[model samples]
Target: MSFIQSLKSSLKASLGSKQRQVSAVPQIAAKASENPDLEKLLVIPVSDDPKEEQQRSHAFNKGQFLARQERWEDLSKIVNDEDQNRRASGGGMPIAELLCQGARADVVALAEHLLIDGTPEEARPLSEAISALEQILGEHSNNHVIATIVAMAHLDIAWAWRGTDAVRDTPARNLEAFELHCTRACQVLDPFCGIELDSPLVTSARCALLVGTPNAQTRVADDYEDLIDLAPEQQRHIRALGHHMLPQWFGSYETLELEARRTAARTQDIWGAGAYTWTYFDAVLVDPYCARYIDIPFFLEGIRDILERSEDQHNANLFASFAAVSIPNAAHLCADDLESCSALEQIQTAAQWIMSDYLHELHPLIWGHAMEGFDNHARIASIDALFKQGREKANQVFVRIFGEQMRKGNALIFTPQGLYVQQA
Candidate 1:
């Protein structure tokens, strides 16, 4: 069978059971040559104003929401409207190419979520979204934006199948679709490699090929040098992903941190540095060998240093939040020995340090939950008013009063069942 034939067969199979036979459908071979202005529709514009930026943000977010809602028809309208508007204006594509790119990623994400949940009914929406994207790609084969989106759509289909036991049981046929889609995605991105190095879509595709599933593993680490050379700012939010992924390729903690710091210095973005550091800590927290390899105190001290070095309050808060999540898990490793002792004292010590250092940072996050109000905005504003009122009181009194107010009946408490929210 041809590529499109195989894809059609796959889509048909998704419509029902794997054993269902699919009738031959005419191959969708519509090429981009037919659409001379296709490239014009795929241009991504930079945001120069708040309104433009918000619109762009909203477009992408709405696309994601549509995908999650399984509203395939709505998604199709978005792409079509953007194409029409782009042609009419000869500029300012309604759906930014980046948003379209994200739409494909969202398709893949929703597909995986459905597969994991093991609900065949959920697959229908994914199949619909996938078919729609495929149709779009059929017409715009050479449009790199749509091509990337289509490629990722294919990758997601393959990823979903890889996780399904029915597909994996057939070794020869198992990754057939998966391999094809991954190759297609790579080929699409390979032509204009440098342009997409910073894209989360591209980064995620590369990561999927590397560490995905056993059947989906491509082990091809391409364009990483180009990635490392790009400054943190240039890398978008995805620069931290390198630090997250390189360990699987035999990179060490020190080397990864050095690369992260170098990228941070090159970009002079402290927030990126904090984000990068958090990725490493996140990895270690899941299975904290870092604490064993180095001393637990040393591991925690490094996190503290990152938090302190963060120039922006947001960055500092972000790093502290990561520490708050990671440190408690890692505390058991903090004892004089990992195998010999429980490390309860060390855990207590670490928790105390985090509480002391990050209480102010945690206050804002917990404050909303504590406040009784109509909505988030009202609650958050009420917190500000309370904080202001407290500030007028003595500093010590203010800290005690607001801290107690926020913690009362709104704190997260561990119970026999699981983590429970204390009700106000």
Candidate 2:
């Protein structure tokens, strides 16, 4: 029996209830020999379409090339384009966000290298890049877009210097460097803080600065609130709000719950109850202890609302994979504490209706990323291997859930257009 299946069997024995509870994790119903036609299924993962992939590639490559060549003016134009603020049709990510990342990818990577091991030799390139960026800022002091890029570069380097170790563990010299970089980052962006002057880049830099700011604990919600309001279509901002509101970051569990609801109301016009779902989504993924705090019915309702509102298959696959794989994995990790935990069991059970009602096509990249909670440093042998692993798992999930349909002379096919059935 699987972990959840074993838990269910135990529950039934203990409760003495006549009603059967479905397994949250799929319970394989029929043997493979019983369904020889399953091998012909076409349920592998795929992108939304090739054209959207090409467009995303073009945007990133062009922006990175502009940044590498130091054509700041040209890069500014792309970031300032109205389309940049709009969410991409392929996935919900903001186009301008990618442009900003491309603009500072070189500097940020160097800073990240210094953050990890702090080798003196690794610091030279980062220092040189900061100096060059600082000089350009002096020449174009009033250009808010240019100032935003430099601010983010400094902000990242600041984190690199401070590192994630506790205060006592951090060296005094590193603390001083962290402060110096943070100060410079704030100074450049301070004048552009007003609403009229804010752009997507400017708003992002402000949010990033909250880590080093003295007033962050009280201001985390406010800063993110401004961001979500500016682009209510962007669910990423709402997701981030829940993260910073966590007890370890700026707020307590109560604060996280409150902010999730507040964001739901605030963005109801755009996301409906989806804002609440996105807020709690990443937090619980990274730390399952937070799962204990989730309001089961409300959270599940938010999930339904999200799938109903968003047409993007990426999101449908994202939540489906998250529920079926990620959250159940969390439950397994905390199995000792979960046996009597009814809420956690119900949370795991949510995957069933989500897969049945919402999921149409598979996106292996999303499923693969969920296996590691989308960690930046999750080790993988190769992209092809990652997708292959994800594909196999996804097929297992679908076969278990839709097995009856498959055995009855129907082949489930997931194309970019949508889910289709072939008569077997």
**lDDT value, candidate 2, whole model:** 0.69
Taking all chains together, the TM-score of candidate 1 against the true structure is 0.48
Clashing pairs in 2: none
The top-ranked prediction according to lDDT is 2
Candidate 2: RMSD to truth: 13.7
Which ranges in model 2 have alpha carbons more than 4 Å from their true place?
A: 1-38, 42-45, 48-56, 83-90, 113-118, 159-180, 336-341, 377-381, 403-410, 413-424
What lDDT score is found at residue 14 in candidate 2?
35
Model 2, 187-250: lDDT tens digits are 8889896357546557867887877788789888888888878777777777877877877788
Q: Summarize candidate 1's per-residue lDDT along 168-231 as a digit string, tens digits.
A: 3644454675666666666655553333534433444444344333432123223343333432
Give the count of colliding residue pairs in each prediction. Answer: 0, 0
Which 10 consecutive positions of candidate 2 have the poorest summed lDDT?
A: 19-28
Residue pairs in clash, model 1: none
